[model samples]
Target: MPLSVDRLKTLLQDDIKDLTKLSEILNKERTALKERSNTAIQTLASEKSTCIKSIEYRAKEKAKMFVDAGYQIKKGEFEKAIAEIQDPSLQALWRKVNIGLRFCQDQNTINGKVVSHSLKRVNKLMDIVRGQHNKPNLYGSSGKENSFGGLNSIAKA
Candidate 1:
């Protein structure tokens, strides 16, 4: 038997709630990243992973339901499914869920960029600190820019 409209509605509502929570977590993670708190970032990353898994599981369930019902899941398919209820109120509620998801996706992209930039900087610093950097930037006493290739000692430069 196909999934019931009420069940789908409930699932979508639950997903919206979960995504809202994920958005809050992402905000906290941004704060952690800004503070450079390694411990907080680690803990928040674990929590975020768990939350993402839950969201993906629910989304897969919804997709399977749609497929089983002879519907091809795609953009706007979920909204169409909800529209079948023919109730403006129900349609609006589910649309809110989709809109919330889209917002979350955009925020996630921004957070990911922040994380990537931070990691790249850390790697560059690590190279310099380890004396493995071939082109370490330095300012001379004349205030001219220079790159030290193999001089690991700052005092000798």
Candidate 2:
């Protein structure tokens, strides 16, 4: 059976709400990461994972509905399809969803970079205390990262 456009719009609105929540969580995660609060980070990670799972589930359902509507499209393409619909209200809703999705993407990327940079700092510190080369990397089994050797025992540092 073909899905109703109204239902699709409703789904998009729900997705926008989910994305907004995820964006907020990502902002909180950034603060926690900057503060080096491991406990807060663990809590934020759990919350973020739950939000992602829910978002994925809803997106899959939305994609399936789009397929049933006669145009097989990815979740993002569903927004494109919605934009072409004749109803202005649906288009407005789709616009909100699109903007919300974009914000979520930007925030997520920022959070990922922050996490990566923090990891590199930790690796650099470990290298320093272990009397290894002052490089930032967790892996040494591969390539130039293994240029220096760490003390066999951390206690010797």
lDDT of 2 by residue, 40-144 (tens): 999999999998898788778877887887876644666567766778988887788778878988988998889877886787788788997553334565543
Q: What tens-digit string does per-residue lDDT give for candidate 1 at 14-102? A: 88888889899889988988899889989988988998898888888888878888778788876676677687766776778778888
Best model per TM-score: 2
lDDT (0-100) at residue 37 of candidate 2? 93
Please report how far candidate 1 places residue 130 from its true position, in Å. Answer: 4.0
**Top lDDT hit:** 1
Task: Give candidate 2's error at residue 136 in angstroms.
Answer: 11
lDDT of 1: 0.81
Model 1 segments more than 4 A misplaced: 1-3, 131-157
Cα lDDT of all candidates, in order?
0.81, 0.80
lDDT score, candidate 1, position 68: 85
TM-score of each: 0.73, 0.78
